[model samples]
Target: MTCLPLLASASGAAIPLALIIPFVLLLMLIAVMPLMVAKVKHWWEHRYPFVAIGLGLLVVVYYLLRIPGGGETIAHTLEEYFSFICLIGALFTVAGGIHIKVKGSATPVGNIVFLAVGAVLANFIGTTGASMVLIRPWLRMNKIRLGAYHVIFFIFIVSNAGGALTPIGDPPLFLGYLRGVPFFWLIEHVFLIWLLVIGLILAVFFAIDFRAFKKTPSAVQSEIGESDTWRFEGGLNLLFLLVIIGAVFLPAKFFLREIVMLAAAAGSYFSTPRAVHAQNEFNFGPIREVAFLFAGIFMTMMPALGYLEQHGQEFGFKKPAQYYFAAGSLSSVLDNAPTYVNFLELAETTVRAEEPAAFAALGDEKHAAVRLLLERRPLLVIAVSLGAVFFGAMTYIGNGPNFMVKSIAESSGVRMPTFFGYILKYSLPFLLPILALVGWLFL
Candidate 1:
């Protein structure tokens, strides 16, 4: 969800700690269910929607019955959720209509180049768009010796860190843009940091991939590099893709943006030939899973978001590095969009408390507070933006595209890591270090 309303109740009273249980339980279920024994795993695979929805309803019921203005809060959240799913579903559907075919298997160098291009493309079409469009071709080119690391690195680069340059690149930045951060502000501020992080991660991926490449037979390696014939199909879907991207700038009232996205999806689906759909193995399974799970996530997270809004200043986050890690840590588990918003609000609160006269002088011109933050403490804004976008790579649920990529990979017969395994093996070891270094050097 992009723009969640900061709860009015957040300023009135503290949320009870017990209300956060459902959110924690849902997260635990997501992390542990797939790793269970075979029978339990099968049960979980089929029944997770019920668990997610049931837990989400518990919180919804509590809010409706107990809290003031709770219905409006829930309605706004559902609206945002609808907008979120529409954009994701539209991108998935349109991307599925276009097919890319490569006659030769990708060598390590070829794979690196592909990911680098995907990283750059993410800025223009968004991480979700770039991931959906390129993931199939990425899988096809590496089918000969695909590994879990291949998918993990794809999530790290194409789906997450690559999108730090622009608001269109990631949801958190887009929300920041909606809240009055300038369009080019992120590129101007974070370009060097983005370049360094992307470069280091690509280097790490290349080293691992090169080692794996050496294990392949010499003849197979030669064959992989032999010929590079590329064919493009369903070129018209590109227009539909552009329509979906452009719709993001539309006002959210009355679902105008979501309607445009769904219309574009339907147009692409109906106009494309079935042959392209068959080649891409297009289906609604992945998107359906995301819709259900995130339904619970958006609902159950209200209390946590409310709690953070009420108590965030007590955490005493004064430095840019503090905002970076604090926001990044929550973004690892929570949806980065709202995490970015809560932290942005917190930063604003802190600044206003410290300098009331400076804030008073602005006198409430639209977004004057944010503009003042940019003027006096731009680094805080940069920290929260980077943390939310970059650390979304830490878990499957951290970003919209990460789980969709995992589901698509699994459907294509790639065995992906479990949720905890992903963090321990890839994020903690690889991504966290690079992020920490960036924070140390830049923030």
Candidate 2:
């Protein structure tokens, strides 16, 4: 439950490759099962918990019965699992308490404005928070012109890239913050990278959405009637959200942060009315699914991540861009926060060796290791941070919010793409090219 070393041993050797299969199978189940079977899709969706737990337990049993350090590995993964679920569940609950209603036509410009606002709000409220608050409004606004592209772009902007500015914005950055990286350090170093990625993606969205808007028939009317006004209900949850952020910002222990977040969620839940939740169409399905699936992922990925922490330098992660692609490629399937932590440890090793005095001055105190690493390689930090946040859009499970957004959109009758379809058809074609360009220009 405490801080963990990135590598299984400081000596640098890979773990057994077999340790990764359960993780791979889980991803395959997530990506392939829905497409391969039509009627069973709903069953697969609801029954993912069994599939995850069964496979996860296989790895646990292997470690518990067969390996020496397995107990420590399981413990670390469990700590991360609890923190991940707590933060995600709390944010989901609190955001669900607030509902926004829009009464007007769903114009392309208006839609762009709405998304742009969300992109900015993501920096403050966390991507998951902003997405939960804004997505329903976005869906309802563009109900007439709905397409898969809308949700896809939503994942790219509000759920990922927009969260680059602050630690609270995304899980990876928050992990970085908890490791002693300064709060403003993230915003300062990544400001241009954020500007470039967010600006370019927003422009691309406007172009695509404008074309779609032009082709749509003019008879589509606003669902909320013709008047143009906006109203917000359950505004007290905003105060609860601020309390959650305050807890995160304080120099509290990890468990304390979890407690604060859960308390905020509890406050929101008990304070808000049933009508508000009904208006938000909020329920526990998305959060529950995320918790179950990620519990398995966090458990299965332990040895693999531990191995990477030790031997990552052997894989030629000597340059900033190398770390970017390496961490990001894995992050596209694995949980990005753990992936970020693994790379952070890997990068820390190289930095500590290179700048012993700088790191020594920072001291070997509790969070000092990460603080020293953060100061050592600004470019490497930038790459790791950007990679974790940006490439997370590659899959539904890449980041926590991706699947939650998909679930919400689906419940609202937005036919989201199947997992593989999402990657091959949309992500590979659209996002990959942009990622390549960003790599060329920035990383």
Candidate 3:
């Protein structure tokens, strides 16, 4: 009985418009307001971005604070917040300015290719593995062609969306494999969605490049046979990627060991053979600001996630698609790995009735039961897996590398938005509907 086709398409079954209508309206409101405000106050508009983020964060904090449980509530808050803090701490300790320097004269097209290559490589190696190898070259390209949209755009589409095709592409997906989804199942289902988003990004880029060409903007112009020398020299901060990844997954007994290893990784980055640092020619100060900004975000949103845990089921999701969208929607803002686990935990208890003990024993691992469910009922496990990995692009923080790309993009001069602000500005306007269309047309 879902009145809205798109909602059902997104959720894979009928749901009342009464519930979805406000959310769509809210997305519309959120998507458009920033542009409206920015247009009006051009002077102080940027300041409101942070203030807007703060207000949204306050709502999340209130959710955490309002929980009426005893020590359990406090414990949940501590666990969630500590996880958030530790993830942030891990990134910063790794010296956060992740970038790469490719050989030859860098062009927007060349860089796009580089990102595409990096995306494939991220999955084959770990996402962190590939990001480390390429980020310095990517940053080097930015230094040579500063002020072009190509740099930040690469970070946005590739560093985040690009990685959806593989488990190694993002942490949440890897965790899904741990829970039960086969590694290849990801590529089998998600490939088309990846192509659709990539194609749209390339199309938008062509248009931006075309307009830049028409305007004859000096900054946008690619040089003619210019020096043809790299002048690279940026911090191929690949080690930073490793240190951060290790901190998140390492066992508790190995905490101090991980810290020392990170210190070593950071130390070694300073000694890289290629002088990519010379290309940037700026201090690491800006990337540091990105770190500070995210710390505030992580600290504030922990409790909101806890609150969602306490009450997410009331939304009445019952299909793979519903979990995909809800989990992803939150993953866009929250860390996707944990969000994936949370929804998975919820879905474990989602079945309406136990299977006849014969079949029900299979219910012990619903994620596995989901793939084998077929026409009997929707496969909720597949829904969670598809949503967890695919929807990470819904917002920046869904996966670890997303923030890294944002940090790199800001350092490159894109002047990106705050945590919630990013979702309103980038994800909703551009990424959201694209994903919804994919859900309807393919997923």
Best by lDDT: 1
Question: Is candidate 1 or 2 superior in lDDT?
Answer: 1
> How much lDDT does candidate 3 score?
0.50
Stretch of 10 with least lDDT, candidate 3: 1-10
lDDT of 3 by residue, 1-443 (tens): 01011111222322222332322333333333434555554543345336434544553444345433323433433443344334333333333244343454455466557666766665544554454446555655545444435544555565566667665566556555444456577687667667777777666665665555456556545552253444323244455555555544454353453464446455644564433334333243433433334333433433333333344457676666777787777666555665665666456435423344434555444344334332244346556655666566665546555656666667756666666666676567766776677666653
Q: Candidate 2 residues 135-156, lDDT tens each?
A: 8888877777789989999998
Worst 10 contiguous positions by lDDT, candidate 1? 1-10
Residue-level lDDT for 99 in candidate 3: 34
What are the per-residue Cα lDDT tens digits for candidate 1 across 1-86? 23233453633755787998998788777756766899999998899899989999999998888878788889877876777678
What's the C-alpha lDDT at position 169 in model 3? 66
TM-score of every candidate relative to the true structure:
0.86, 0.86, 0.57
lDDT of each: 0.84, 0.78, 0.50
RMSD of 3: 9.5
Give per-residue lDDT, candidate 3, residue 378.
39
Candidate 3 TM-score over all chains jointly: 0.57
Q: Which ranking of candidates, highest lDDT first?
A: 1, 2, 3
